[model samples]
Target: MDRFDQLRILTAIVEGGSLSEAARKLNITPSAVSKQLSQLEDRLGVRLFNRTTRKLSLTDEGGVFYERARAILADLAEAEESLASQSGQPRGRLVVDAPVAFGRYCVAPVLGEFLRANPEVHLDLRLNDRLIDPIEEGVDLVIRIGQMKDSALIGRRLSKSRRLVVASPDYLKKKGRPKTPEDLKAHACLLHSLRRPQSEWQFMKEGGGVESLSLAGAFESVDIEVIRVLAIDGLGLAQLPVWLVARDLESGALEEVLSGHLSPDPDIFTLYPSARHLSPKVRSFVDFLVERFGGERAWWATKL
Candidate 1:
């Protein structure tokens, strides 16, 4: 195989975590992947992976090689993308990821306009709540809510939103509105399973201190949409992003409670692997997101 092909195979194996998976991703047979890896290793006089019946792990030397190989491949890809972008049209397969609910309700809806505007670009959008490494997953961009934790990626703030306690009018009427942060404990509070320590809720105190309370209820879900639905069904009160419940609040189907006490949600962000020399396809998409959701134009942010 050529040097670039070897590099691609090696990186794919590491990212895919197995020869078979790498084969699937590369559209090659597992045996071919194995042979290529073996040839590549023999040519280098180094063992690249420590293999076991159930898994594969890179050796220290393999890890070092993998990092350099990744950089070389990235630089090559960027070089090609830079040249192609000089033609002034963004044309390529652009892969993006986002949280399920937000991707469905927010990101997916805007994609049609973007695709129509850039007809040469192919879009592959993946929606999952799991945190994915963009470089490993080959994702061009990711839309994320909550805190920006990954220091490796570059993040552009799309908008800022606050988490607000909301319940159906019927629920509030039956459970009675919670007058204080502590009072939430007495109400049936729908919780998000993904939100750590599911029962612990934080609120901003009126005088600037923070109130942390452990609140529980009948319903809890990993999906924010499910939690929103449960709250609307009067199953329990839910602390949800303002964007998620903007329509409900506007239609009077849900009432916001303790708005003064709810802490701000982490800023919405569109994250990418790098800021420098970004491919036109990625840059255009990021710019599109900013235009759609960034300051003043963010309808969701305005709802609060």
Candidate 2:
């Protein structure tokens, strides 16, 4: 039994959630995967997994072993990557995750150039709005916008996007424009359910102080795009990222409100699991994004 090979198989099974799925990922039959797991357990003299009809879960000892195994595998990969990096070309599969709209509009457009530049690398991009655990999901990188609450992950700020209170010209005409952040209380606001405190809006006061308002909205949705559409249709005012609503603002489909008192811009970050030796693929990709987005004058700033 190759101990390293068994470790790889064990991690694969844990990550893939089942023996069959691990087999598919490893390009082997389920029986072969099962045989390896059984052999590994026999050698160790301990049960590694608790199997049910629907799923397989790690035993207590297996859980402890898996963590150590993962670290060993990561160290081995890093050693191999260090050798590969000497050739000055990134290779292997890179799994990345980003929000849907940003991934579609900003990230996707630049991927062609990235792929063209690095012919040896293959990218697997997953677009999701939900926050994902990069380590658990086997993701190499995640592009996230807004405040990051998780301190466990390492991050690099790629760009910044301000939240703008905006509404359609028609909506503001009928509802009347708010002259101050305080006046927003009387107007119908469109809220993003995913945003923290859903109804509270934050802004910077003229006196270098921060103020927050607990607002009420006639419309709300888990999707920011939904609120954007509703706001565009004269439904209510919506505060959205400037990057997400830049085109609309430029086209006069939406007009900025209380721009003077808008909240501090949220940063765009590429997050990865905290590690001492960063993989070349992740490092190169992050550098590419920072340059593509513009280190200081990000593309989104042009719209503003």
Candidate 3:
């Protein structure tokens, strides 16, 4: 057995928390993963994991080994990056995770240009609304909107997006415009299920305080795009990221409401694992996104 390869497999299992998950990430069969673990344990004469029906936990010995193994792997990665940078070309498979709507409307549109610029780089883009753990998933980078929860990862602020309460002109005409946040209770509000307190909306007060209101809706959806469409069809009021509705606002399909009293702007961020040496591929990709988005005055803002 190659000890180095077995060490990598062992760390993958620990990070993934199950044989099946590790196998999926490594692109190997679960049986193969199990066999490698068994061999490694036999050679070391020490059990690495305490396995239960639902999950796997590290043994005391495993914890010690895992820390050292991770350090060794990080060092190896840094050495590899140093050599790759010397060549001055970004290559290899780069895995990126991004939110669904933003990836579809913004990031995905610019990918072809990135591909053309770096012919040797292979891109693996995964678009999902769920928050992903980059280190656990072996993702090279992730484009995230809103406040970041993971401090262990390094984040580059790409842009800022305002969260605005909006409604179609036809809807406002039919339902009548709400002059205050309290009036939303009487209006048909479209709720985004992914947001916390889905029925409650938050805003900044003119006197410099935060205001929150519980709202009722005729329509609700986990998908932001669906809510935007529902609002456009004159169904209800919807609060959405400016980037998503910038074009709609420009086309006069949607109009901002309570413009000066909406929540604080949420930032767009590109996150990656904190590493000793950043890979050229990750570096190049992040720089390209920053330049494309134009930092504070993003392309989305330009549309508005």
Candidate 4:
């Protein structure tokens, strides 16, 4: 097998785990894939994979090769694109990933405006609560909430919104508002499994700093919208980022509980794959997000 083809197979195997799955993705048969892997290992003089029934794992040396190979492939792809004229307006399939609630209320609107501005550009926006791996999944950009830790990726902060502890008036009336962090144990605390910092339901203790309080709620949901609905129905207290509860708070569907507690505002960042120089498509899209949501009163900011 050709070295380049071998590298491709290696990447596919790393991502897809099973040889059969990798072959399916690469449009080859399982036996062909095994043959290629064996050839590549012999040529490179290293054990590339430790394969088992459940999955496949790379040898340490194999990981080093995969990283270098991936970079080389990216360079070749860039060269191919560079051969094509980049002088025209940015236009292509820009696959984006973002949190569901943020995508619906924030990214969707921005994307709509972006599409209108750049008629040539098309979007495949996948909105879910899970943290998506852009490189493996072939996503162009991702809008995320919280800190950026992965050194492999690049991130740009778009906005910040404070977290809040809120419940429906009926819920507060029934359960009584928590005056202290200790009181939270007595009430039904609806959790947003996606929110990292506030996942434990933090509170401002009387002295200083913060305290984390455990919770039991009538319902647990991964969907922010469903959590909002449950909170609106007086199911339990929900500690949500202000953006999710602002409209309800304004309309009196939700009431504040233990107001003085929430931690620092949760920062929102538009994360993209690390690159030396970003293409106009990714660059322009991230800039648009900053312009729209970077201001103090940006749309996603918490009002309550």
| Whole-model lDDT per candidate | 0.86, 0.87, 0.86, 0.78
Clashes of each: 0, 0, 0, 1
lDDT of 2 by residue, 1-304 (tens): 4899899999999999999999998898999999999999999999999999987999999999999999999889767778767876687778899998789878887799898988877799999999888888889999988877767889888777768999999998898999999999999998988878899888998788789899988988988778888988999999998778888988999999987786977788888889535667777898898888746564874535
Q: Each model's TM-score, in the order given?
A: 0.72, 0.73, 0.72, 0.67
For candidate 3, write residues 1-304 as lDDT tens digits.
Answer: 4877788898899888889998998899999999999998898899999998886999999999899988888778657667888897897778999999999988888899999999978899999999877888879999988896758889888877778899999999988988888888999999999988799888887888888898877888999999989989989999898888989988999999877576867788889989625778988999999888846665875534
Candidate 4 TM-score versus the reference: 0.67
Give one digit per residue, the lDDT tens place, for model 4 in 1-304.
6778888998898888879899998999999999999999898889988877876889899999989988987777666445433773566657889888877876776566799887766678898878777888889998888776756889888778677778899888887888876787888777766565334776565687777766665567777788889989998887777777778888899987767665666688888888534666777788888888886674754333
On residues 75-141, what C-alpha lDDT tens digit does candidate 1 reach at each position? 8966777777897678777999999988887788778999999997889999999988888878989
Error of 2 at 124 (Å): 1.1
Candidate 4 deviation (Cα RMSD): 7.5
Candidate 3 has an lDDT of 0.86
Model 4 alpha-carbon miss at residue 3, Å: 27
Distance from true position, residue 108, model 3, in Å? 0.7
